[model samples]
Target chain A: MTRDAIILAAIAGAGLLTVLLFAAGADGAPRAIAALLFLLIGPGLACVRLLRLDDPLTELALAVAVSLALETIVATALLATGSWSAGAALAALVAITLAAVAAGFARARGAGSPRA
Target chain B: MAAGVPGPARESAGQAVSSSPGPAALAMAWPVGRAPSWLLTLAPLLAALALWLAAIPAIDPDQMTDLGLIAVLPPAFYLALGLLILGFCALLGRERAGDWEPGAYIAAWIVILHGTPAIVYGSLRYAWAWKHVGIVDYIQRTGGIDPAIGYLPIYHNWPGFFGAAALLTEAAGLADALPLATWSPPFFELLFAAALLLVLRAVTGDRRLAWLGVWFFTLTNWVGQDYFSPQAITYALYLAAIGLCLWAFPARMPLAASPVGRVVIRGALLRRLAADFDRRAEWAGAASSALPDLSTVQRRGLLAMTLALLASIAVSHQLTPIVTILALFALVLLGQCRAWGLPLVMLLFTAGWMATGASSFAAEGIREVLSTLGRANENIDSNLIDASLFTPGFRIVSNAARALTAGVGLLATLGWLRRFHDGYLDLPLTLLWLAPVALLGMSSYGGEILFRVYFFALPAMAFFLAALFAPRSWRRGAASLIVVALASVVLAAGFLVAYYGHERSNYFRPGEIAAADYLARNAPAGSLIVEGSPNYPSRYHRYEQFVYVPLVAWPRGNVEASANAYSLADIEQMMADRHYAAAYLIITESQKVEMSVPGLASLEAIQGEIEASGDFAVLFRNDAATIYGLAGRQGAEP
Candidate 1:
């Protein structure tokens, strides 16, 4: 696979891991382990992707997007566990979905494309 | 490649020779990308946690909670609302065929940069929850049960509102009501962050720059420390409105025939229709050349955003009509007449709606604008003195050669000038529109509330700073460094003032908490505990039933009766009549002066006479306070 595909896969995998950890419950040993894992793994893969890219701006945007996604995922997982109410849960979902879709579409347009 | 020794140069010039790669390029190729995305995201959060943990030894959780309660909500909610509004505005801009990114960028930058710190500070200081403890106690006393049980409507008391809301939610069977206290601030912060990001991305078109802006703003000391204030919420509302306005622009204007054409082609329906079409084409051509037509969707979006902006402002915990007006004016400038005129009109109407909808402090709100203007004038004068390049010879000589340092002296003056310029312009514009209302608040003349109302300019100040100093390139790093250094010094000064200033001793300390515990444990039930004066010391023992009676009130048997009677003689008579089980006399330095006064001296003499008569026994004695009990009093006495 191309390096770009590899990076995307890694980001997706990290996102999935975060989702699972959040789903598993955010307390005690399990949540702590998940948080540590994400904290370590997520930024690691993101940096790799950034270094492989030629454009600094794109790299930064990708890094920020990943970070935002990670936060969203953790927050969502916490909400899903009934930690937050239905209204809040819905709001979070909507916000995350919108952001993710926008990011994904932008990414698909090719890295380092000058903004219109 | 000089002509004198040009053999190699000539050969290379004839045959194009490529130079070897440079060291910088080679260094850039190194495999230095080990850190993953999630790690980068978590880094700041971890750093914050570490800092908090490090400070844990010195910082008390209770004290932190007190700060958190006041600083968190306003900024967070405002940012969140701003984001939603921005999205709608973006949609509007698309329809109107206007570039709405600049407005969005400004809105997002303000919300994220300012909103983050507000959340952090609010989380730290949670004691604001206790501000309404008296109201709760009053309710309990009157109702003869837990006040939370009754669903009685409370007025504009924040704590009461939270308590009542929590109780109601709990009644509806929500688990873990306690967590809501912690969750509320962070939840709002997250919402604000999201909104800020969204709006920024829309406006800048470059998401990376938007993120940078967000990070830069959040890292500022003011944002980190003052999140719990109502200004944060006002900011969020303002941003949301801006976003909505961006969304309102129509992608394309509706095509319509001219009135002259319709009148001329009155007969033959087909001919009339043809004429109408031709006229419409002419009009479209003219409009397209003059201004970009907006789509219906964009117009509706802007309308929606405008409404949202108004709603957010109206519902803000702190009344911020001044901020709302400033933002509205900004929108007008942004709209640039013609096509934007309609939106401006709509915004004005919405603002009117918000003004009418504001529930509390409506009459006193105007003072904020006046005070803002006053402070602005004061600041301008101060800046002029500080900014003057030349000083009188005597004054300069007296200060020594240390009067100016090359690096900071010039830059500081420049920074001061920049700040002054922004403040002067913003302050006047804000006051001009808001002065009438501010006058009303001034007339009411409540101290802190008036100040709080006036401080609505804080968010605007933050936005101005961001606009002025946010670096777009490496060269601007110097400016950023200066700002950071100056802000740090200011923050350090604030800490010093808070820690060691004259009012420091007035704050409730751990020692006071211990004293309160002792009083609660040992004092007899239903026994009247009287303090010597109604001062900060008496307030420190507020948890206890300590009724502070002045020395002159000692002659009166009934403290409450004397206060109601409002006469010194009546107070003395009542004090003489009442039977107190115990009296706690707290004599601070301030009270010693009162003792020198003739009337107060006589009261003290009366206390001395009573003591000599063996009517009371000294229970506790300290330099700060002395507690005396009736000689015949027993532990079980009511």
Candidate 2:
């Protein structure tokens, strides 16, 4: 599959998983697994693009680290601003993921190639 | 260099590539063909997974008795463990791991390797885990932290981890952070594997050593700090931070400029002041890692981003920031880092946070940290001895944990000895490994400082451990294979000791959580809710709803009023005391097992006493748990 197509598919999968996750509402193993993928997918892809590292495992690891730090920053901002809510936090995460993934792809395109 | 598999391994001087023929050529000449296929290496992992699947049905949380995760698992668990160990040896035994594919395969095995008990376990086991859920729930409900002066002050002060969980739980529309806790071990282990590999490569620039170090780390990591906790996230960030720093901005200074001109760095002052920097060593053999890997702008951006990560860590956990500060400074001092400004920035952020956001919690530690400057043993003992909960094989587990740690220490020492043997000189890495131990002089972190020290030091130690194999000396393929497997088995044994060490206390029941939730929901605000012991899932949710009074506070020091109310006869007098008013007492299944097995108390006698007494009435009762409301003096007189 094309790289763009894969990214789109991942986003779509995340969307589907997000809907299924909410629909399921409580706990089930599959949705839980889906939740893991959905939360990590965008950030993971973004990390791969932004890190510009050769190793996929190393890229993924940095992505988790960056995503966590970003999430913490967002959460801290929300708490500090008195705007902290579940909705606000989720929006911040999605926004950060989208921006990061977009910047990563842009960097890749500007460099005229993609490693991940 | 030690010849590992892949492309013709990097050779030293005009020497033939291997002590035998070559790793690949040796393998071909020995029993195996060119090399063992990936499928053969994967077989043991796949088989181990199957055994784990078979053992799941045998898990009975009801009869959890003194034993924990081991009880429900079958002998197949042992077979699976054997398979994992065998698979590791088989993978390394082939004398290859030069490519990323093999590393990926190993990571896959790691996921399976750690996933067994993590997935099969019934519910969240650790007592602190339930409280973590509650912390997230609290944050979700109210975005601000509730200042906790005593118990959970650190998490509350830096609510980054809990805040993220709250967001994820919200985004996923999950009830709580239960799934996160359940699946955390394997997921974190996999991510950690990636990060550790990056560090190993950065330090040695050898893929083989990196891969071997990662596998060794997994086998030996008996420290269970990676479970759904802030340390898990911070540990990942810590490694990522180190990678970004070392990869992007490695300094130009090589320790040995004059091969014949010896420079012995002995005391602390000399090490600190010994920065003469041999300018004539331009002809030194070691290639400069000083050149920026990325463009200047990109490198600067990465450094800026790393500082932000440090800021987040500073805000999240209390201890990790200290470790980060020490590491960054070590880098700067050793000339492994160009940016001296970064450590100062980290220091300001850490000290700045401690003064402002973390002030409420810091007041309690100022004197203790001052007085306990060199009392590492006392600090270590306080944590281990005070928090020890006895179950069946506690001694065996404790000894195994000690042996595992000692074995690691020995291997790291061997790395130094090997440095003398191989004529390798890099004192900075050794200094970095020892840096976290300095944290011992800091507060004991309520006895857990030692474990945290170990956690932070693992990456550095892994690098040194990689040295045990003649990885750089390509000819010593056989020795490399033997050394790597022996290291793996040692760590695997440690993994057993660490994971199984606190099974009884770590495993919690659904009913225990149910009773705690009931108290959270039903108990009037600020009312006293007494537990038979502090083992139940209480105070994690709606912590302020009731004053949590345990009948017996074991393993944690405060036994005053709790010790006085251990029996039914004492229950009457205990209720009449001014401190006792409209209090509910809970007795749980795990509590009963704990009481009887340890001979702490007779559950039957306590139950019988409750039945005979008129001063108490059952408020809520289940087969697994019971809640009673003390009537105080009203029932006592009548």
Compare the candidates by lDDT and give the number of the best one. 2
Candidate 2: regions farther than 4 A off: A1-5, A8-35, A105-116, B1-36, B61-68, B93-113, B148-151, B254-292, B363-383, B386-392, B444-448, B469-476, B556-582, B592-612, B631-638
Q: After superposition, how far is residue B614 of candidate 1 from its true place, in Å?
A: 8.7
Instruction: Give the per-residue lDDT of model 1 (tens digit) for B379-441.
Output: 111112222332232123212212211212233334334534422122222222243235344
DockQ of each: 0.04, 0.45
Which residues of candidate 1, in runs, are more than 4 Å off? A1-116, B1-33, B37-48, B58-129, B133-318, B321-454, B474-638
TM-score of 2: 0.82
Model 1, position B299: C-alpha lDDT score: 44
Residue B416: error of model 1 in Å?
Answer: 11
Summing lDDT over every window of 10 consecutive residues in candidate 1 chain B, give the lowest-scoring window: B6-15
- Candidate 2 per-residue C-alpha lDDT over B10-37 given as tens digits, one digit per residue, 9 for 90 to 100: 2323333434322334354667644455
True contacts kept of 2: 0.53
- Put down candidate 2 lDDT per residue, A47-108, tens digits, no spaces: 44565544566556666777677778778777655578766665656665666666755665
Best by DockQ: 2
